[model samples]
Target: MADIEERRPRNKATTFLLVLAAAAFVVASALRLLGIDGTRHMVATTALVPYFTAAGVLLGAIALLARRWFVGTVTLLVALVLVAAVAPRAFPDARPIGVGQEVRVMAANLLVGKADAEVLVAAVRDHAVDVLALQELSPAMVVDLERAGLDEVLPHRVFLAEPGASGSGIASRYPLTARDLAGPSTLRQAGALVALPGADLEVVSVHPLPPVTPDGPEPWQRDMAGLPRPDLNGPYRVLAGDFNATLDHVGLRRLLNHGYVDAADQVGAGLDPTWPADAVWPPPVVIDHILVDDRCPVDTFQVVDIPGSDHRAIVSQFVVPAR
Candidate 1:
C-alpha cells in the first residue's frame, strides 16, 4: 500500500493543469449566452458562431490535458477567450432590418410517398405562410401537387433541377425572382433565393446534406467551409433553411464561425426536436433547422409536428420592429 501511494506521487503540475482546463471549459460554457436572444434557428448568424467557439473549448481542453504545464496553461486560457469573449464580439446579435412586413416561413420534409400534398397544401393555405419550403419532393408528390394545381395558390416559386432522390423547393405567396447558388455551394443544391415584390426581404432556402458517417470529416468541413458571408453581400440580409447540423456535430461549430444564428436556440422554450422521422419514439437527434440573418429579429420559432414526414416542421415568425 505504501509503494502504491508512492507510485501515485502528487504531480502538482497535472493537478493545476486539470483545474485550469476545467475552468476554461466553464468560461467557455458561460460565453455561449452572451448577447444571445435564445429564439432562432433555421437561420445561420444567430446560433452558429458561439456554438463553434463552444466546441473549440472542448477541443482545446483536450489538448490542454496533455501534461505540459506551460503549454496547457496557454491553451486553456486561449480556449476560455474563444468561448467567452471572442465568440460574442465576433458574431453580432441579429437586428430588425427588413421592410414593413411580418414574414412567416415554414419548412417541412414531405417524406416522399408518406407525405400528403393535399394535407400539406391545406396546412400552407390555412397558415398563410408567406414562404413555404419543402424537402423530399418525390415525382409523385409533384404530379399530385400539380393535379391539385397549387401554382395558383403559390404566386411564385424557385424550383431548380430535382434535389436528389428527394427534391427541395420553395413556394412563395409573393412574387419570387429567383437566384440559385449552384456552384458557390458548399453543400448540395439545396439552395435558392426568392425576391418578394416591394418586400425588400430576400429569403435564401437551403438543405445542406447532413454530415453523417465517417468516410472523412472533410466532406462535412467542406460543406461548412466558405458559408454565405453576409459581409460580401453587404446588408443583403435574408433567412436560411439551414438544416442545422445536430448538437453532437462539429459542423455546428463551423456554422457559428460563419456568423449564423439558429432561431430555435434563441427562443428559450423547449428544444425543437425534428429528425429521425422513422424512429420509434420521441427522437434521437435534432437535424433539421432554420437560420436567419442578424438583421432580422424573429419573435417566435416553434416546432410544428406534421404527420407524414419523419421530422417535425420548424416555423419561424419575424416581426422586425423599427430598424
Candidate 2:
C-alpha cells in the first residue's frame, strides 16, 4: 500500500513535468499561427498553412499528455502575445511620415483578370494616383490598362519586354522622357525605369519572386543587390511593388538597412494591408508595399482592392523633400 502511494505521487510529478513542457510548445504553436514570428520565410510558409496550423495541434498534444493546467495557460498566453505584436503592424499608420511634400503612388497586382482590371481602373481614376506600379499583368492587360483613361492623368510610362513571364509596368504623372528597364532574370520581372520627374530621381518598380519557398528569396536578393542602388549624395529614389515578403523578412530587412523607408508606413495609420485580398476572411497580409528613399516624404497612404486578384492596391501620397 505504501509503495503504491509513493509511486502515485511520482507518476503525478512526471505527468506534471511532461504537461509543462508541452504547454510551452503549445504557446509556440499558437504564436506561429497568429502570424507572430515574421521571418524571411514566413510569407512562403503561408502556402502550407497546414504546417503552421499543425504546430498548435502538436503543442496541445503535449499539454494533454502532462495535464499541467497552469503551464498550459501560461504557454497559451505567451503564444497569444507574440501574435498580438505582429497582427497590429498589419494596419496603416494613423499619422503621416513627414511634413515635406505630398505625392501619391498606387501599386496593384492585376491577376490577368478583366473584372479586377475594371475595378482597379475605376479606383485609380477616383483617387487620382500620381505614380503606379502593377505586377502579374498580361500583354493584353497592359494594352487595356493604357486605354482605361489613365493616359491623360498618368501620361508618362515605363514598361518591360515580356520574355514569357508575366510583365511589370509603371505609370506616372511626372514626365518620363526615357527608361532603362531590364526584364526578369528568372521567373519574376524586375527593372528600373528611368524618368526625368521635375528634378533627377531614379525610381524603380520591382516584382521579385514571391517567396513560395527558400529557393525564391535567394535569386531575388541577388538581383536586387545588383541594381544601380541610388547614389547617396544625389537623387530621390523609390522601389515599390509586390516584394512577396513582409518587413521582418531578410531581404526587406536588408533593404531597410540600406536606408529604404516603407512608403505606406510613412503616411499611413497602419491601415495598409495589401496581399490576400480576402478582407472578410482576411488572410490579407501586407505583401504589396511602396518604399521610398529618405529624400521623399509621405503625406497619405491607403490600400485599394482589385476585384479578381489576391492583392490589394497600395496607394501613397508623397513627394521629394526640399534639398
lDDT: which candidate is best? Answer: 2
lDDT string for model 2 (1-323, tens) is: 98999899887887676665655555444434554434334444443333333444455455555675565555556545544534455455444244444566788777653435557778877888767777766777766766776676788777653533357777777766344533344444444433443455556666776545456456665555543445688666777777776654556656767877787655434435666777545444566777777556666677776777778777777766544
Model 1 worst lDDT run, 10 consecutive residues: 36-45
- In candidate 2, stretches whose alpha carbon ends up further than 4 angstroms from where it belongs are 1-43, 46-101, 113-115, 161-165, 177-184, 187-198, 213-217, 224-230, 267-272, 279-282
Q: How accurate locally is residue 156 in candidate 1, as Cα lDDT from 0 to 100? A: 78
In order of appearance, the predictions have TM-scores of: 0.62, 0.70
lDDT of 2 at 208: 70
Native-to-model Cα distance after best TM-score fit, residue 135 in candidate 1, in Å? 2.3
lDDT of 1 by residue, 1-323 (tens): 98767656565555665666566544434434343222222222233434445555665556556555554565556556655543343233445455546777888777653566676676676676778777766667777766665676786777543534336667888776665543354433344454544334555555555444344334444555535544334333444453545433445545555665666654542244566555745333456666655555666776666677776777777653332
Report residue 254 deviation for candidate 1 (angstroms). Answer: 3.7
